[model samples]
Target: MRERFDVVPLAALFLGAASFLMPFAALKENRVVDGLLLNGFQLAGPLYGTVAVLTAFGVLTGVFLMKNGSRRRLLYAAAGVVCFWLTAALLVRAGMMLTGGAAPRVSPAIGFWGLPAASYVLIDHSKKGRWRMWILLVVMLLPAALLLAGGRGEAISVFREWSARKGRFFDELIVHIRLFGMAVISAAVLGIPLGILASRDKRIGEPVTAFVDAVQTIPSMALFGLLMAPLAALSRTFPLLRAMGIRGIGAAPALIALTLYALLPIVRNTVAGLASVPLSAIDAGLGLGMSQRQLFYRVEWPMALPHVLTGLRTASVQAVGNTAVAALIGAGGLGIMIFQGLGQAAPDLILLGVIPLILIAVAVDRSWGFMIRRWVSPGLDMKGLSA
Candidate 1:
């Protein structure tokens, strides 16, 4: 057997070198003005700059030196995360050194993003791990938390934007979560039964699934646009809906659009889950004189739970990202910040909004998965059932 060289660490090293060769940080005079592009050496000075270089280099060289795969993985994960955190810190430090520790409009440049993204990918193992993935998130985020708590991050461009809009941030974040949450929950409630029905009855299933799948075909913005007219009419005709804030350009339309978008993955997965249930198990349930409802509740549904959760997980993550577009219609989420940032030509404001949006998606993806793995019976998994 040939020894397989680890490409992960090499990729990390390539990204790190790119960080050194290209601009590591962009320096701006103000939030909306362009300035200079600073390399790692230019931004962090000798000590921190040298450390960054050595850290990045050590990740690849050290990993190759170790023949043991476990040791190589451990080294790369540790070094990669450190490089990522350190790159962020360097951006913060650069701001301080240049602007007397007050707010500085310094953002991570293209080169800076490559390394951290590579590092993040390095530790983000299987999406299935109960704790491993969460632990990686914590490890990755701790530096940001500490910098913010200790106030060192205040000078960084992204934090400066946050400080300016702290109140609006929370308000918009709540709306974003609400839109995403309601959409996914609504999808699950409506999708699961339809999925089950489709599995149990071909007549009802084919067209229903076809429609749900068709919903996904429409561009999200176009779907949102299509809903606007009916929603606007409803609000005008129904005083109660108007009183309840069911407007065409706000949460009501946004929520409906997001829910429609969320249904397909869920319905597809639910159908798949139920379809995948064993004939033997169904026969056993029938042998005990169990009716269809009893079999579904007691045997089929329970056995298909992991797959259901998988669908829910998929829908939830999609909803979180899709909810961002809701901001365009005044539905409001972190997307507002992103759009505002773009309108104002302020990169930091965009980062403040975009980062949290990514985090929310990651949180939904991880937490739901963690719950599925931790609570769902090991035997209930599709793979287990097939075996």
Candidate 2:
């Protein structure tokens, strides 16, 4: 048979190989100061040279040479991921071991960034990643998760930043989740009804559509600014509101603005999903003694659900990012660490905040995709979804 190269594994090889070519980590005296670059091979030469070199060869043979759909191909790819994982963990441990008496901290450098990036692509490469990849991926990640939970990543700069602020960090993280949840839920509550009305009545649809579309055009900062005054005034006017923390520059105004920004996507998708429902299905339901409401609930809604989930998925991810901006108005979340890191010129601190946001967004998006695939109405066309 002729030889063929898969883009996914090739991409993984490029990233992982490229990562080691440059500095793998940094040694710093303090969080904000200039640091010395350390090559993985130099810092932990025996470990890096052996594992990385062996894995590079393993990836080439196992992923590149093996036939597509072969179990061995997948096993090799998963092994490559696990090898890289051990290289990172053990290398960091060795590096930290060196710093015991000297006391200078170790931080990730530019090249260090590629390890996880390469692993992610490798994850995608493992048999289209539909089953979430070879068992090796799970085995490797389980301990990593546990270590992170146990706060054992002391060698990495971001982990150090996390160690310093973990108490407040958890608190801010919960608040951030709340902000994202409230925004998406509020938008869905109002947007879905408006979408239903819009589908049934063009008159109401056009105006509501225009209004939500206009809301999207406004910059988030400006929207937050606009809501603050009215909220502040309301709090002042109503002692009840003030006691409930409905101030202009806090969660109240931030939630209102985030909800407004989230509305357009939800409303637009709701309209699209409903309209996409087949008339034949509705007619069939009605002929079977179903009333209009029964038809909507039993026939139309089931068909439209996948699209509705898509819109909510979009809104959910968007809310995660926008919630970061809400921190500017004292609506606390991970953004507090980000802005504070910026003010102090601490890159690791910024990363401590930014990384979580990225993870949260990816988690939400993937969850929605999982829902559409597994839990949605069987009436949905798989072809449309794949497209």
Give lDDT: candidate 1, residue 263: 93
How much lDDT does candidate 1 score? 0.79
lDDT of 2 at 294: 88
Who wins the lDDT comparison? 1
Candidate 1's displacement at residue 277, Å, is 1.6
Instruction: Please give, for residues 1-387, the per-residue lDDT of candidate 2 as tens digits.
Output: 775646766666676765566777777776766777866566656765677668677767765556777575566466556646654574455456544433356777777766677777665555545654536657767766665454356656777787777899999999999999999999999888888899899999999999999998999889888898889899999999999989989899999899988888889988998999878878888889999988888888878787788888899999999999999999999889999999998888888889999999988988888887776866568555531
lDDT of 1 by residue, 232-326 (tens): 99999999999999988999999998998889989998898888788998999999999988999998998778878888888999999899999
lDDT of 2 at 118: 73
For every candidate structure, what is the RMSD over all alpha carbons to the true structure, in angstroms? 3.1, 2.9
lDDT of each: 0.79, 0.78
